[model samples]
Target chain A: GAGVSQSPSNKVTEKGKDVELRCDPISGHTALYWYRQSLGQGLEFLIYFQGNSAPDKSGLPSDRFSAERTGGSVSTLTIQRTQQEDSAVYLCASSLGQGTKNIQYFGAGTRLSVL
Target chain B: DQQVKQNSPSLSVQEGRISILNCDYTNSMFDYFLWYKKYPAEGPTFLISISSIKDKNEDGRFTVFLNKSAKHLSLHIVPSQPGDSAVYFCAARPASYDKVIFGPGTSLSVIP
Candidate 1:
């Protein structure tokens, strides 16, 4: 991919329904990250996957939020029993590596609306 | 508590003038700072960055300055243009962590 690519740019679902967001990082990127922006709030870190290392899930807001990266290339973020508060823009980013020189490239984001 | 803060919600600047965006952080462990510019409907793009070891870094018309003592960092755009108008976010990275904390963002409008 030319850059980080996210799918289903916008999603609208019932409050209790489950939703999944997909991210296809740039080819050969070794690091992937997930974040979200709620209304006027800043970007909040969710999860990170680096190579085959165990993901850093400290930033996940709750048990309902989970993510998985397969083969260190494609990633998926799933929200279970979504609430109204979950309505926001979900963003995905990828970088060459997690070193100090890491510069992330982001996707346009998927706007999720929980009715 | 917010680790990073961009107090001003918005800023307006005239074309050919300088646009200054400020950010403050409370965490002392942050070792790297970056600025990202975002336009409506698009993801943010990396603008400039400065390391804690140095007080300043510049690229073309964009410059970033860091003050370790004051826990503040600012981005400056010289001769601002209308095309530069967008929401700018300030982000910081801790030396031992891969996560980056971001500010609320400040929207800048450059008038022609």
Candidate 2:
């Protein structure tokens, strides 16, 4: 793909139900990131993965939020027992390398609504 | 805590005028700053960026200015056009950090 791509552009689910979001980064990119954006709020870092090393999950808001990058290309973010607060746009980005200078390309994002 | 802050929620500028958006950060460790432009229903696109070693960087009509001492940065759009009307976000990352912290966006309305 030319850029990062995310699945299920929009999702509506009931509270307490589980939801999963997927991201496919650009080919050969070494770093991938997940972020959450609420209405009128800035983007919040959720998780990061670099190559085959263990992902940086420190930014995950709670234990319910988990993400895994398989084969260093595609990633899945799963939220268990979705809450109303979890209703936000989940964004995925990828960069050539892991550093501050690397330019990150972002996907259109998946808007998830928890009712 | 909000390490990066975009105080202005919105700004309006007449067409052909200059649009200046400001961002401030409390973390001195940030060595790279970038500005992104986003439209409704679309992901953010990189506009311009400035490294801590330099004070200013320009590309086409967009320019980013960084003040390391004040921990402040600003994006300037010269001869703003209606097409430039969108939400602008500022992001900062330290030299060693891979994740960038974004500031609450500022909505710029370029009035014709």
Candidate 3:
């Protein structure tokens, strides 16, 4: 793909339901990131993956939030027992390198609404 | 506390005029800064970026200015066009950190 791609552009789920969001980064890119954006809020970092190294899950809000990147390519963000506060746009980005200076390409994002 | 901050929520500029958007950060460890522009229903696109070592960087119509002393940075769009209307976001990353912190965006309206 020419750009990062995310699945389920919009998802509506009841509270306590589990939701899984998928992201496919650009080919050959070694770095991937996940972010959450709430209404009228800035993008919040969630997780980061660099090659086959362990992902940096420091930004995960709680135990209910978990993510995994397989083969250093596709990634999945799973939320268990979603809460109303979990409603937000989940964005995925990819970069050719690892670091702050690398330019990240973003996907259109998945808007999750937990009712 | 917000590491990166864009105090102005919105700005309006007449077409052909210069559009200046400002951002400030409190963390001295931030070594890289970038500006992104986003339209409705679209993901943000990279506009310009500057390293802490340099005070300025320019790309065709967009330029980024960094003031390390004040921990401030600004993005300037020369001869702004209507197509430039969108939400602009500023992001910063520390020297060794892989995560980027984004500021609350500023909505820019380039009026024709």
Q: Tell me, by TM-score, which candidate is best.
A: 2
| TM-scores for every candidate against the unseen true structure | 0.96, 0.97, 0.96
Q: Tell how far residue B19 is off in model 2, in angstroms.
A: 0.2
Which residue runs of candidate 3 sit more than 4 Å off their true CA positions? none
lDDT of 2 by residue, A8-112 (tens): 999999999999999999998999999999998888889989888788897899999999999889999999999999999999999987643778899999999
Q: lDDT per residue, candidate 3, B49-89, as tens digits?
A: 99999999999999999999999999999999999999999
Best by DockQ: 2
Segments of candidate 1 deviating more than 4 angstroms: none
Per-residue lDDT over B9-84 for candidate 2, one digit per residue giving the tens place of the 0 to 100 score:
9999999999999999999889889999989888888888998999999999998999998999999999999999
lDDT of 1 by residue, B1-112 (tens): 8999999999999999999999999999999999999898788888988889999999999999999999999999998999999999999888877678789999999999
Could you tell me which 10 consecutive residues in candidate 1 chain A have the lowest summed lDDT? Answer: A95-104
- Which model, 1 or 2, shows the larger TM-score? 2
| CAPRI class assigned to model 3 | medium
How is the predicted docking of candidate 2 categorized under the CAPRI scheme? medium
Answer with 1 or 3, whichever has the higher DockQ. Answer: 1
Considering DockQ, which of the candidate structures 2 and 3 is the better prediction for this target?
A: 2
lDDT at B10 for candidate 1? 96
Model 1 Cα lDDT, one tens digit per residue, A1-115: 4989999899999999999999999999898999999887778889989889999998899999999998889999999999999999999999887764678899999999999
